[model samples]
Target: MIVRIMGEGQVRLDDVHLAELDELDDELLAETRSGDEEGFRRTLGALLDAVRRLGAPLPDDALEPSELILPSPDATLPEVREMLKDTDGLIPG
Candidate 1:
């Protein structure tokens, strides 16, 4: 089953995905510690995809902003920047 994270809430993952992600995260940690480029890339890609699916818009959209503009014009840029930065260049245009 797919996990759903509603707005203003913590993200939840399916058990299988969570387990796999945990393993991948562990592997990522190991890879980072050991300087394994391929492992790091795979882990990073998986995590980034998870994040994107949680919040990103459809790929067909031509005018996607880094952080989607909500009703709040006074939104903090730093938080938005952090979320986008967390994507680690995994977001496709």
Candidate 2:
């Protein structure tokens, strides 16, 4: 799966990682819903970190469509909330 971290480049993640990413996605949604700013930041950082650690970074010039799009590391909670409202959390179930 191709995942895009906004403000960063794209990553080509294996399908096997989806389950783990989903768990983090769930945590992110929960944190956002509860208005836990600290938790939201932490979880979002973790999610982005996990993607960087587990997935291979695509070249900056790559133009493949991303299967999932995650907020940038510095994204605000309100921005994330608006993003979530338009779709499911970062990863689709």
Candidate 3:
């Protein structure tokens, strides 16, 4: 799967990592739902960090479509809330 961290470059993640990412995605959604600002920050950062840790970064010029597009580390609660509204899971299925 190809994941894109907005404002950053793309990454290529294997299907094997999907379950782990899904867990992090759930945590992000929970934090947003609970309106826990700190949790949101921590979880969101952790989720993005996990993506970076587990996936291989694509070249800066890569043009493949991303399967999952996540918010940047500095994203705000409102921004994430808007993203979650898509109902595609944080990792977007």
- All candidates: TM-score: 0.37, 0.96, 0.93
Candidate 2 Cα deviation (angstroms), residue 5: 0.4
lDDT of model 1, residue 51: 50
User: What are the C-alpha RMSDs, in order, of all predicted structures?
Assistant: 11.8, 0.9, 1.2
In Å, residue 8's CA in model 3 sits off its true spot by 0.5
lDDT of 3 by residue, 1-93 (tens): 899999998999998988898888888898887899999999888899899999999999998998888998899998999989858568754
Q: Pick the candidate with the highest lDDT.
A: 2
- What is the alpha-carbon lDDT for the whole of candidate 2? 0.94
* Model 3 CA lDDT for position 56: 96
Model 1 lDDT per residue over 11-84, tens place:
33334455545554555555555666666666656654565454434334233233321112222334323434
Q: State the C-alpha lDDT per candidate.
A: 0.41, 0.94, 0.88
- The model with the greatest TM-score is 2
TM-score result, candidate 2: 0.96
Report the Cα lDDT for residue 31, model 1. Answer: 57
Candidate 1 vs candidate 2: the TM-score winner is 2
Clashes within 3 Å, all models in order: 0, 0, 0
